[model samples]
Target: MLVKDIMQDIGETKKKDTRFTNRLIPFHDVCSVSSGDIDNAIKSAGKEYLKDGSQAAGQKFMGVVKIRNNNTVNKESIINSIGDIFTKNHTVDLNDPDFTIIVEVFRNVCIVSVLTDYIKLRKFNIFGLFSGGFAEPKKSIHKDP
Candidate 1:
């Protein structure tokens, strides 16, 4: 619901003669979760993304999945499973895509999105993702005024 609200807000603010039929989306998770639920959640989210009419004409899209606080679901396995759901014509264009999907799997839920822009991705820091968990926070150098 929040994603839809945010999309509507962005569409209204952009003031562009554009349709949301094909635009990249970013996802945020806020649902209840349980063991072995990632697969279903992902499938459901993917369907929602498609139903939103966000997939571009060519089905050329990019994606990034984040898993936090999950211990059982393997990212590779999820990717493989999800990949199969797409049409055979689907292709991943990492460098430049008609749209991008961001999948965030948190402790209690999973979220999949088709982002409208890549701006939000600039803040994603790979250095923060560690083997066990997010990398420890580094000390800030700037002092509060």
Candidate 2:
């Protein structure tokens, strides 16, 4: 099965849970490619993402691209390569981004995908959740008067 199909299936399954509202889908076109072609693959994927954006001016938004290097290619080299591409051709925001692009590189091939619409996961405040910043609603028990 295609990676897209797998992602869609996972999204559908996750939607059954009430907590998950936004279904983050990875926009991918080509499935596999050589490790050396990472930059081209990302560029193609980014362009496709821009084309799909309905808003005029191709939807002005910020995002960061990451590479998960599981192959022989040095991780630093991958980071630098992706960083150069972004700096030279695209604008990215690290603090708050509308989306995230990830490239998972294996020995023979790599996968590129754009991710967005993480409403629930984004809103979660780890510090607050751990520090009791949110409280559960209390139920009142009534006694016969």
Candidate 3:
């Protein structure tokens, strides 16, 4: 299913300087990567991420991230590489759980969310999480309220 499909409408309202409103879906709009453009974005970011001079984890994180907008991320090949990245090291969940990865999609752009979670986070201020999910809303997004 698409990310927008699961998002529950939270009604449109103004926040700060922008007229903001969300289709508030089950998943947190902080780690989503739209299938529409993420193919290319994944490729580009993955290359840079792999060359960041840090130890690669290689954990093959497979799933879809939720978000409010999809226009702030590079769409093309970032997601695909990140998914494959796990297979090389497999330490993604054990080490880099902070900066909760999320994606926001809005027609022409994909906004990746470097999320801050109150649980299961290993690193703080790591808001530059280079992670994102597909249109599918995993169980994590939808929780019983």
Candidate 4:
């Protein structure tokens, strides 16, 4: 251990932020949807969740209008892609929502659900997911001994 090692770096946790054993880290840059992708994602979110096979609505493709990136386990970027589906005029009342569509473009996986208020959720298939993620068989991951 060197003397410099003991010195703290910027944003390092201090005594105030600690909560028992877990040190409360000052919020760091999160992996949320980039500003550019927000508009289409939100809009896509709304339409995909609405009635089945609802093609992209005519709602103007306004870019991601709002960004509230925080520490959500599932990166907001993934959600934002679907979020882009919403229009500004569209009302999204979390309490009693019409529908909630989750589009994972990366894996070409879309989960659609008609909302019974935001709390209750059930899944249905909408558009065929076009995204794809890396696939590896367990055997391929490691060579047999």
Best TM-score among the predictions, by candidate number: 1
In model 2, where is the ten-residue run with the lowest total lDDT? 136-145
Per-residue error (Å), model 1, residue 64? 0.9
**Could you say which candidate leads in lDDT?**
1
In candidate 3, which residue ranges exceed 4 Å CA deviation? Answer: 1-36, 46-48, 58-64, 67-82, 92-99, 113-145
Model 1, residue pairs in steric clash: 24-114, 24-115, 24-116, 25-114, 25-115, 26-115
Question: How do the residues 1-145 of candidate 2 rate in per-residue lDDT, one tens digit apiece?
Answer: 2433434344444422224333333546444545457767777766644443333222222333334544455656656665665544344444333455666655456766655532223322232232342333223232212
Residue 129 CA displacement from its true place in model 1, Å: 21
**Model 3: ten consecutive residues of lowest lDDT:** 7-16
lDDT of 4 by residue, 90-136 (tens): 43333333333332222222222222211221111111111111112
Better candidate number, 3 or 4, judged by TM-score: 3
What TM-score fits each model?
A: 0.50, 0.47, 0.32, 0.26
Separately for all candidates shown, the number of backbone clashes (residues 3 or more apart, or on different chains) is: 6, 0, 49, 20
| Candidate 3 C-alpha error for residue 100, in Å | 4.0
Error of 1 at 59 (Å): 2.7
RMSD of each: 13.9, 13.3, 13.0, 19.6
Candidate 1: list runs displaced more than 4 Å: 1-55, 119-145
